[model samples]
Target: EDKTASDLFKHYQEIFPHGNRNAASHRWAHFVLQRSTQMTPGKVAYFFASFCPISGSPIDPTPQTAIRYESGHGLPQVSGGQAEGIIHHCCWPCICDSLKFLRVDTKTVSTSQGPHQFRFLVYGNPCTDPTRIPAEATDVTCSNGRLEASVLSDHGHVIVGMLQDNQPSIGASSREVLEA
Candidate 1:
């Protein structure tokens, strides 16, 4: 648990000489082979939930993003040598944080059931694109902001929301300590 990010990165590098996220099966081998990691079940769960912007949610898995950068793109520029950016696996927050670090203003919309966040490319200054926003980007929403456009709802009309009967996260512990 005390292992720094650099230590974990080194461990990954040792396993993946090429990279952690190649577009082929070679990268898959490392993830499949290294089935047992130091992360506990609770720790992993908490780690995943950290990516979510809010509480009370349905399962939503996002497609993994792959990016390849050149040497001049904030990376070391090697003379003549091919610039190999470190391809890696990233969660939602990791992606958003990186963009924000580059001065991109990212926004997250939170509601009763879950959250919604969007990203876009801006022209002048580093900023977020309003047109390329999340589906539930609007503040005035219905059914936890999970409703589709086909379903029409009047603002004054009443809308009902449901809760799941069995969900472990409903009463999970705040702390993710290892159990003996």
Candidate 2:
């Protein structure tokens, strides 16, 4: 049994066999967990929860893949009670495609001196937006006071580029090593 497969998941050995789950996957999960805890510094449990804030899908059980994000990064608070800050989790696909999740509004207003550009980042209703952000979907872009909506758009493009640079190997290898 892999030592990293904690006691919490011991009973599910068949689903997460020793050979399939590798060090890289564990390292990635740990890095995400640590970063998440550092950012929120509260509510660490949400980091490991199987829920994906973006797609609302159950994440892979073994060698879980997750991207952590803060709540105000672009998520709607229908109840109007959501704290601007809280950690949330989502899958890689959701993180990679986050630019689409946002609704950007820009208007140029005439000020006393000149035209001023106002940019707004709007969060769509989760039910209507095809791209939903996981509590984790905040992506690295919005962490540590990087809460600008432009960051979300720029970061998503960067993520896509990184994935493309890695290409078939990164995707195929992660599945082969992490999937049960």
Candidate 3:
């Protein structure tokens, strides 16, 4: 017999045992997808716990912040001639470390001013260690002003992008890595 959403929900509740419906459903989906595609265990597990396990928040992406270049040599200048970029937001201090993750990538441009930069960071799920930043990365400084990071992740064959803001109103983006 075909399983309905309710049936899937019931199965998830049984499998999760200690989690809520949302968490259970997510886990179940992850398990089924992993099994069906014969994906590696490490990648499957990584995908399942990519976001915060408890609060479902993306890992904080505030590690390296954008550098405010007075000369605007290598940065993306906005209409106001301001360079915007991404920063890492550490979650271990504020929230349960078990439920945070992050990832980021940035590009900078050189302007007549000096050096300008733009960055993107992703938070929640798969908490990233900024100190151990991946290779081929550009760092941004975030002490002077607010910054933002755009995140990209691939799941199955889908590429998803999200914008993480670090201003007065900072939060997660609703974007997900789904097949196009």
Tens digit per residue, CA lDDT, model 2, 1-180: 112224334433332233232211222233333333133311222222333333433343232342222333432222332222111224455553443443333333233334433222234222233244244433312334332222122212110101111122112123211211
Tens-digit per-residue lDDT, 1-180, candidate 1: 443323333444443344322211222222221331444433222222222212112223222222232334322211222322222223334333222322112223232234433111111210123344344433212233332211111221111111111124322222211112
Off by over 4 Å in 1: 24-38, 45-180
lDDT of 2: 0.28
Clashes of each: 0, 8, 47
The global C-alpha lDDT for each of the candidates, from Candidate 1 onward, is 0.25, 0.28, 0.28
Q: Rank by TM-score, descending?
A: 2, 3, 1
**Poorly placed runs, candidate 2 (over 4 Å):** 1-49, 60-64, 68-91, 102-122, 126-180
Write one digit per residue (lDDT tens) for candidate 3, span 1-119: 13222433344434444444222123433333424234433222223323333233333322221111222222222122433322222233322221133223332323334333323
Error of 3 at 30 (Å): 0.8
| TM-score of each model, in listed order | 0.21, 0.22, 0.22
Ranking by lDDT: 2, 3, 1
TM-score of 2: 0.22
